[model samples]
Target: MISGSIVAIVTPMHADGSIDWEALSRLIDWHVEQGSDGIVAVGTTGESATLAMDEHKMFIKACVDQAAGRMTVIAGTGANSTSEAIELTEVAREVNADACLLVTPYYNKPTQEGLYQHFMAIADAVDIPQVLYNVPGRTACDMQNATTVRLAEHPNIVAIKDATGDVARGRELIEAVGDKLAVLSGDDATAMELMLAGGKGDISVTANVAPAAMKAMCDAAIAGDRAAAEAANAPLLMLHERLFVEANPIPVKWALAEMGMMENGIRLPMTPLSEGAQPQVREALRHAGLLK
Candidate 1:
């Protein structure tokens, strides 16, 4: 089981918006040193939408190579087109990624049946462990608990990153598919609650800046230690909320740059954290003790 705080790490980029391999390596090493349980490379937060196919493959391969077995690497291999998704998953498998995280097809807004078939087809095509990512807010396609439970029967479909942020629904999914598929919380603010209700871990945006604290909270929550988990999470509430003040990766990438972890280089369509939101993110970072 790939559990605990699996960081949905941002792909470090230069001012010109090109991949910064050196900064990426440094970030990977820092995560390992900081006790992050695993890393999700080229996921939504990694700006997978902006990266070209070649760039996507390169980032995944680079993360796998850099981690060098120190931690699990779950590559984001999702596409609205099933064939494209299969191709990406094949690449992830070829590169020996620990697993692949596939967000529900976006834009097209496939039905539950379409969702099931799409996932089933990918699982059938690739033998690698797969984690289904269901963030309706972004994808516009919500994979309901029933559909998720149905897909859980597939051996390769090992987990689901539920970003719905409904603790009640999350608990229900865990109860239904907990034994069959690991239910990982994809929403940072409600992650500890989901974990306390039998979730395995979090595919976290917050972990991008405060990995050690996220890991500690996950560890405590997974171990059923509410007090410990709450203690670790209390300081992060502001961060959990503020990082989304702008679109994702916008605020998170800015947070990383503010902490001197990366350059302030967000791609077009997604601008740098606005001047107005900068202080809010900075204060959140300071509250989390990630900045001075």
Candidate 2:
């Protein structure tokens, strides 16, 4: 199982909105050094919606190559179109990524049957392991517990990234699935509690800036040591909440730049962090001791 803190890593870009491949490598190295167990390249936090198709494939390949087997690399291949999702997943498999993370289709919301069929189609077409990403807040399409349970039966469906942030519901899914498939928390804020309740680990945005801390917390939680997990998580609570002060990757990209990890570069439709939000995010970094 690819467990522990898996960073939904940002795609570093230059001021003109071009991907900075060198910076991307640096971020990956930092994650490996910090002990982050895996990465989801070009996920929502990586601005998957903005990248061109070629860019998406190239980005995933770059992440896989840079990691060089140092950590798990999961390509974010989810799309509203089943064919498109399959193509991306193929690219992930071609690049030898450890797995693929497919989000529930957004916009044109699909029925429960549609959702099931869509995912089943991808799992059937692709031979690689797949992780279902359910973040209704972003996708506007919730894959209900029952639906997820149904999907769990597929051999190719290895895990589910439950971003609902509903600890109670997440626990229910974990209990229902048992070892049929692993359940990873997509919400950093409640990740500790969810893992304590038997969740595998977290697919985290907070891990972007605080990799080591996030990994340590995840390890402790998975070991069922509440005291160690809580101690490690206390400092990161601010980051877990504040990084979303604005739409994702905005505040988080800014936080990374603030820490000199990357430049303050984000694509359009998503702007740089607002002046008002900077102080709040900076304070979060300070609380986590990532900044002075």
Model 1 Cα lDDT, one tens digit per residue, 182-233:
9999999999999999999999999999999999999999999999999999
List ranges where model 1 is wrong by over 4 Å: none
Candidate 2 residue pairs in clash (backbone atoms < 3 Å) = none
Can you write out model 2's per-residue Cα lDDT over 1-292, one digit (the tens) per residue?
A: 8688999999999999999999999999999999999999999999999999999999999999999999999999999999999999999999999999999999979999999999999999999999999999998999999999999999999999999999999999999999998999999999999999999999999999999999999999999999999999999999999999999989999999999988999899999999999999999999999998
**Candidate 2, superposed: residue stretches over 4 Å from native:** none
* Global lDDT of each candidate: 0.96, 0.96
